[model samples]
Target: MNLHQESSGEITLLKQKAFNLSSESIRDEIVSSAFRHTLAICQDVTKVKDQSKLLHTEKLDKILTSRLFGFPIMLAMLGIVIYLTIAGANVPSSMLASFFGWLEGYLSLGFQTINAPDWLHGVLVLGLYRGTSWVISVMLPPMAIFFPMFALLENYGYLPRVAFNMDRLFKKTGAHGKQSLTMAMGFGCNAAAIMSTRIIESPRERMLAILTNNFVPCNGRWPTLILLASIFMAAGFTGAAGTLVTAGVVVGMVVFGIIVTLAVSWVLSKTALKGVPTHYTLELPPYRKPQFMNTIIRATIDKSAFVLKRAIVIAAPAGVLTWILANIMVGDTSILMHIVQFLDPFAQQLGLDGFILMAFILGLPANEIVLPILLMGYLSTGAMIEVEDLDSLKKIFIDQGWTWITALNMMLFSLLHYPCGTTLINIYKETKSKKWTFLSFAIPTGLAIAVTFAIAQLARIFGWV
Candidate 1:
C-alpha cells in the first residue's frame, strides 16, 4: 500500500477503537481500573495523632449526609442565611432610600433651575434616577448580606457538601451533579449561573443546567419577595418575630423554586432531552477555616457588585421606556393605562390586576424594578414612587384592591415567570440555539400561568379569595 492508503487505514482503526470504547459499561470498567491503579501507588504518609478531631469531622459529615436529616439541615441553613439577610438589610435599605429621596429633591430643583423641559426632568429624575435608586437600595443590602454568607460557606468547603447532598437528585433527573452548584449560583445571579454550566463536561447536561438556572430566585427577585412577604404574609406579627416569619416565607419560596427546578428537569429529561445520566466522581473536600475578610471582599466585589451593576444597566433604560409609556397620552388615558386595561381580564384570572401584569411585562428588562413600576401604575403617578416603608407600600396595595390572593399569586408569578432580559441573553449565548432559548422562556412562563390560574380558580370556588 502507498502512504495515503496507510494513513487512511490508521484513521479508520482509531475511529473503530473510539466507537468500541464509548459504551457505559466499558467506560465504567476503565474508570474503576484507573482508580484501583492510582490507589495501589498512593499512600497515607501523614499520621494523624489526634483521633478526636478526625472522629468529630466524620461524625458531622455522617449527620449532614444522612438521608433523613440531610435535606432538613440544608433547609435550616438556607433559612438562617435568609433570616440574616432580611434582618440585616432593613436598616441599610431604609437609609439608602432616604438619601436617594433627599437627593431627588436636589435633582428636581437642578432641572428647574436649568430650565429643562418637564418631559426631560420626568424621564431623567422621576424615571431613570428613581428606578436606579430603588434597585440599589432594595437589591444591594440583601446581596451584601447574602453573598458574604454564601462565600463563607464556599470558603469553608461546605458548598461541596451541599452539591454532594444534591447529587443523587440531579442524577435521577438526568442532569449533571454539578448542576446543584450552578443552581446555587443562580440564587445569586442567573446569568452567572448560566455561565458556570461550562463546568459540566457533557453538552446535554450542561444545556439542561443552563435552561433550569432561572428556576431559582436571583438577587434581583429578593427585593420583591422580601417586600411582599413582609407586607402581606408577615403583617400579623411584629418586631423580630415578624421579620423571622417573613424570612421563613422567603425560604419557602426558595424551596418551591427548587421543587420546580427538579420537576422541570425530570420532564425535560424524559421528553426533549432524553438520555441516561452519566456518572462522575465528586470528592468531598476537607473543611477549612474561612478567611472572613477575604470572603466578604470577594463576595461583595465579584458576586454582589457584578450582579447589581448588570441590574442597574438594564433597569435604567427600562425606566426611561416605562416613563414614556406612562406619560404619553393617546386619548383620554395614557398608553400605559390602555395596555393595563387590555391585560386586565387575563390578569384577573391569575389573581393579579392589570397594573401588576403590566408592571411585570415592563419590568422584564430587570426584575428589581417590578415593584416600583407597579407602584407607579397603581398610583397613576406616571413615575416610579418610593414609599417610605413597607406599611405605606402595603397601604397602596390595599387601596388598589389587593388581598392575600393577589399577593400570593404575585409571589408565585415572580418566582416562576420568564427570566429577565439579561438571563435570556445569556441563555441564548450559552446554548447558541434559538430553540433551546425559546424553551428556556416558554417552560417557566407556561408553568407560571398554569399554576396561578389553577390556584386562583380554586380559591374563588372555595370562597377563599
Candidate 2:
C-alpha cells in the first residue's frame, strides 16, 4: 500500500480501539494512572524527619478545614473582612461625598454662568454627575479595601481551601465542587462569576452554576445591604458595638445568600438539570507568602477598576433617564410618580413602597445606583442626592414610613432579585441559549417576589410590621 493508504488504515484501527473502550473504564484508568504516578514520585524523592510532624501551614489547614470548625472559621473570617471594609470605608466615603457635594455647587454655578436651562442643569450636574459621584463614593472605598484583601487570600492560596471546605456540600447538591469557587467569584461580580462557570466541565453543572450564581450578592449590592443593616438592624446599638452589629448582620446576609445558592443548586440538579455530579481531584497548593504590593495593584486595576468602570458607564445613562422621568410631568404628577403609583399596591404587599420597587426596577442596569434612585424618588427630587451620614439616611427612610419589615424585606429582595443587566448579558453569551438565560432571570426574580411577599404577609398576620 502507498503512504496515504497506510495512514488511513492506522487511523481506522485507532478509532476502532477508542470505540471499544468504555468511557467509565477509561476515566478510571486515567485517574488511577495519575495517582499512581504521583505516589511513585513522592515515595521516591520526598523526605521527612518525622512521619507525624506537620508544617505550620498544614496545622492551620487542619483547623480551617475541620468538619466542626471549618464553617464557623469561614464565617468569622468573612465577618472580619466585612467589618474592616465597613469601618475603614466610612471615613473615605464621607470625605468623597463631601468633596463631590462641594464640586456639585461649582458645576451648577458654571452651568448657570453659561446660561444653561434648568432642565439641562438637572440632567448634567444633578443627574449624571451626582449619580457617578455616589457610585464612586459609596462603592470605591469598600471595593478598594475588599478586593485587595480577597486577592491576598487568593494569592496565599487560601481560596482553594474555601472551595475544598465546601466540596462535600456541593457534591451533595449534585453540583460540581468547583461551583463554590465560581460562587466566591460572584461576590466580586456576577457577570464574572457566570463566566467562571466555564471551569466546570459538566454541561449540566455549569448551567446550574450559571443559573444560581446570583444568589451571592455582588459588590454592587453591598452598599445597599450595609446601608440598611447599619441604619435599621444595628440602630439600637451604639458606638463600636453598633458597628460590630452592622458587620455581623451583613455577614448574616452573605451566609443566607450562600444557603440559597446551595438550595437552588440542589433543586435545579434534582429537577431541571438532573445529572450525576462529576468528581475531580483538587490538589491543594502549598501556602506561600503573598506578594502584597503586586496583589493590591493587580486587584485594584483588574478587578476593582474594571467593575467600577462598568457600573459608572451604565449608571450615568440610567441617571439621565431617571432625571427625565422624575421631571417630566403628566397631568399633576411626574412620570416617575405615575409608575410608582401603579406599582404601589403590589409593592406594599411585599413590604416595600412604590418608590422602593421603582428604584429596584430602574436599578436593573446597575445595582450601585438603587439607593440613589430610591432617595430621588422618595424625596420627589429631579436628581439623585446623598445624605451626610447614617442618621440623615435613616431619617429619610423613617420619614418615608419605613419600618423594620420594609428594611428587612428590602435586604432580602436585594439579595434575591434578578441579576443586573450586565450579568444577564453575560449569561446569554455564555450559555448561547435564550432559554437558560431567561430561566436565570426568572428563577431569581420569582424567588425574590415570592419570598418578600410571604415575609410581608406573615409579618402583617403576626403584627410584626
Candidate 3:
C-alpha cells in the first residue's frame, strides 16, 4: 500500500481499539496502576513511618469518619455551628437595625426639608430604602458569623469528610457522592452551591445537585426560620431550653430537606434524568490547623459580600414595589390588599395568608426581603415596619392571624420554593438549557405547593391547626 493508505489503516485500527475499551473502567484501571507505582516508589525510598501529624489525623478520622460515630459527631458540629451563628448575630443584627433606623430618619428629614413630593419621599425612604436596610441588617450579621466559621471548617478539611460520610446516601439516590459538598455549600448560598457542582464529574450528577441545592435553606432564609421558630414554636419556653428547642427545629428542618432532596433525586433519576450512578473515589486529606484570621477575612469578604450584594440589588426594587403596593389606593383599600385578597383563598389552602404569599412572590429576586415585604403588606398605616425585635415581629404576625400551623407551613414553603432570580440564572448558565432551567424552577415550586397543601389539609382534618 502507498504511504497515505498505510496511515489511514493505522488510524482506523486505533479507532477500533478505542471503541472496544470500556471508557469507565479504562481510566479507573490506569489510575489504580499509577497509584500502585507511586506507592512502590515511595516505599523504596521513604522512611520514618507513623509521622505525628499523620498519626493524629488517622486517629481523629477513626472517630470522625467512622460509620458508628460519624453521623452523631457531624450532627453535633452542625448544632454547635448553628447555635453560634444564631447567638452571635442577635446583638449585631439589632445594632445594625437600630443604626439603619436612625439613618433613615435623617434621610426622611432631608426629604421633608427639600419639600420633595410626599409620593417621592415615601417611595425613596419607606419603599426602597427600608427594604434594602432590612436585608442588610438581618442577612449580613448571620451570614458574616455563619460563613467564616463554615470557612474555618472548610480550611481545616472537615468538609470533605462530610462528603465522605454522606457518600452512600447520595449514591443510593443515584447521585454522585460529591453532591454533599454542593449541598453543604448550599447552606451558604444556592447560587454558589450550583456553581460548586462543577466538581461532580458526571453531567447527570451535577444536574441533580443543581436542581436540589435550594432544598436546604440558604443564608437568607436562616434569619426568618430562626425568628419564626423562636417566636412562635418556642412560645411557652424560655432561656437555654427555648434556644436548644429552636436550634433543634432548625436542624430538623435541615434533615427534612435532605430527605426531600434524596426523594426528589431518586424520582428524577428514575424518570427524567435516567442513569445509573457512577462511582468515583474521594480522597480524604489529613486535617491541618486552619489559618484562623485568613479564613475569617475571606469568608467575610467573599461569601458575605457575594450574597449581600445580590440581596441589596434586588431588595432596592422590591422594596420600592412593596411601598407602591402598600400605598396605591383601590377604592378604600390599598392595592396591596387587592392583590392579597385575590391570593388569600388559594393561599389559605396552603396554610399561608395572601400577604405571606405575596411576600414570597416579590421575594423571587432575593429571599432576604420576604419578611420585609410581608410586613409591608400587613401594615395599614403606611408606616415602615421595623423588625427590630423578635417580640414585636411575632406580635405583628400573631395580629395577622398567624398560628403554629402557619409558621410550620412558612418554614416548609421557604425550604422548598423555587430558586432566587440569581440562582435561576446561574442554573441556566450552568446547564445551558432552557428546558432544564424551567424544570429546576418548576420541580421545586410544584413540590412546595403540593407538600404545603397536603400538610394544611391534614392539619385541618386532624384539628392540629
Which is the leading candidate under lDDT? 2
In TM-score terms, candidate 1 sits at 0.91
Off by over 4 Å in 3: 1-41, 48-50
- Give the per-residue lDDT digits (tens) of candidate 2, residues 1-465: 654565566556545666677664455455655675566668768886664434766887898888989889889888988998988999999999999899999999999899999988998888888888888888888888888999999988889889989988998898988999999989878988999999999999999899999999898899999889989999889878988999999999999999999999999999999988887678878677899998899887886667568857888888888999999999999999999999999999999999999999999988999999999988887889887777888999999999989999999999999999999999999999999989999999999999999999999999997
Candidates in descending lDDT order: 2, 1, 3
lDDT of 3 by residue, 382-412 (tens): 6347666678888888888888999999999
Q: For every model shown, what is its TM-score relative to the native structure?
A: 0.91, 0.90, 0.90
Compared with the true structure, model 3 gives a TM-score of 0.90
Q: lDDT for each of the candidates?
A: 0.87, 0.88, 0.86
Model 1 gets an lDDT of 0.87
Error of model 1, residue 110, in angstroms: 1.0
The 10-residue segment of model 3 with minimum total lDDT is 24-33
How many angstroms is residue 100 displaced in model 1 relative to the true structure, after the best TM-score fit? 1.1
**Candidate 1 regions off by >4 Å?**
1-41, 44-54
